[model samples]
Target: MITEKAPGKLYIAGEYAVVENGFPAILVALNQFVYCSIEPSTNGTGKIVSHQYQNNAVQWHRQGDQMIVDQRDNPFSYILSAIQVTEEYARTLNKPLDVYDLHIDSELDSASGKKYGLGSSAAVTVATVKALCQFYHLPVNNDRIFKLAAIAHFAVQGNGSLGDVAASVYGGWIAYHSFDRQWLAEQRKFLDLTTLLNLPWPNLKIETLTAPANLALVIGWTGKPASTSQLVDKISLFKARQQAQYQEFLNASRQCIQRMINGFHAGSLEMIQTEIRYNRSLLQELARRSGVQIETPVLKQLCQIAEQFGGAAKTSGAGGGDCGIVAIDAQADLQSMINQWTAENIEHLPLAVHFMNNVHRYTIKLK
Candidate 1:
């Protein structure tokens, strides 16, 4: 059996803006991970099991070079899509296939089966693709795995900025500009699987970023889960209706993300905090203009609490709910911050960067 694991992701900045053309996002891979284990199936069939989704396992089979799982409504659609897309990639390389039983486990909390918005879906997709590639002895690396996992994610979700997927593949702080999804989606319909897999994705930009050494990153869960895809769709609609305003917001978001990136590299605490405040303000403004509350009351409370603790805090993703993160000086009283957050009923997730720059490969072991 071959096992592979990928870290969950947190968005440091750039949420809605990254879906727009050329806007950059900052993301970090969390220490928490989604793990996948693959081994040949003795029953001449395929099965997938997830510890987090106990009843979702289903048998699958290859039908005319396409593997079809038994249930279309299975909760583990990301894993199934990853396997299907990887199989198509193998066909591109003329590599033979095998039926395997895949087991998935995750450290990202889904207390009572509700997601924590830690990018679990993307993590599992990345981990599964890597494990399958390893199990089949196919040549793969971080970049290739990223592309394959991205395609699978897109196939399953219809749309995503892929910042989380990149974080999972690259496993560090990243300055990410999204691919032109409008162009890519159109291309996906007509392009052959082999050619599509090899596309340079010229519009995408992903670079490893270094944190300012004295910066302390902390995450606090609002105890409310969010649907990122739903939020993205709402923003997309708002953008379609308010083109001029959306363009202006997009520009501000781009500038804020750039400043944040620079702060990380230069170790400028002032610059980092200032830009984070700007980012939070822009998100609030965007929410106002879009007729949505991206920053819910509890999230605002978290930000206020972080500011009280001498840091800047903001919601991490599509923030109707889920976690918010704080960036502060390393010497700040972290436990005090956590204590306050707890009193306010926010769960502090003790997540930090688990890997440094350019360390993108998944942890693998043979059993």
Candidate 2:
């Protein structure tokens, strides 16, 4: 059996604007993860099992090179996409396919099956792709894994900056610039999977960052799950209606994220926190203009409490209600802030940054 894991991620800054090509976002992979384990099947059939879904395991079979499955099981979408895409790449290498039973388990959600706004889907997709690459004896590196997983994830999710996929595959602190999805969609019409992976994706960039030594990261969960896609959709609609306002938001977000990236490079905790506060304001203005509740009332309280405790905080992702992140001086009174959060019914999640040392070796060529 081969097992692989991908860490869940939280967006640090650059949320709504990052979806546009060449826009940047900062994200960190958390210690929480989704694990995928696969082993060869002797019965000539393959099954996917996940404890999250209880008894709804998906049974699938190969029809030629295509994997056929019941369309009713939505949970298998990401897994199946990963399998099909990886198998396609395998075929490009003249490698043969075999039946395997794959099992998935995740720490990206609460015990009661509520999502914590961690990037579980992206992590699961990356884990599946990595496990299959290992299982197929493929020569895989971080770049290969990220590109493959991004392709699989995009095929299913159909939107977003794919920064979560990058954070999952590369781990640690990363500044990610999104590629042109329209260009990628066009390329997929004629390019083979291997060739596509090798191509320089336009405007795509992923750079690992180093946080200040004394910087402290804090996470608080509001216990309210939000639909990221739905929020994104609403933002998209707002963009369609208010093009000028949307453009201004994008430009402001780009500048704000660039400053934050500079802070990361310089190892300046103060600069980082300053930019975090600014980014929070930017998102709030965006929520007002777009008329989407990117930050809920509880989330506002969460950030305010962090501010009172001398930490900079904001909603982590697309943010209707999920998790908020904070950056502060390590010597500050973190426990007091956490205690206050508890008083407000916020759950303080003790998640650390998950780092994969080797991911820095993978570099992308710009087009």
- Best by the TM-score measure: 2
Global Cα lDDT for candidate 2: 0.90
Instruction: Residues 1-367, candidate 2: write the lDDT tens digits.
Output: 9999999999999998999999999999999999999999979998999998554455567999999763322447888999989999999998999999999998988988888999887888899999999999987788889889889888877789889999998888989999999888889999988889888899999988889999999999999987787688799999999999999999999999999999998999999999999999999999998789999998999999999988999999999999999998999999999999999999999999999866654444445
Q: In each prediction, how many residue pairs overlap at the backbone (N, C-alpha, C within less than 3 A)?
A: 0, 0
Residues forming the 10-long window of minimal summed lDDT in candidate 2 = 68-77
Model 1 lDDT per residue over 268-359, tens place:
88898899889999999999999887998989889999999899899998999999999998899989988998999998888879774457
CA displacement after TM-score superposition, residue 68 of candidate 2 (Å): 20
Query: How many Å off is the CA of 98 in candidate 2?
Result: 0.4
lDDT winner among the candidates?
Answer: 2
lDDT for each candidate structure: 0.84, 0.90
Error of 1 at 158 (Å): 1.6
lDDT at 126, model 2: 97
lDDT of 1 at 58: 60
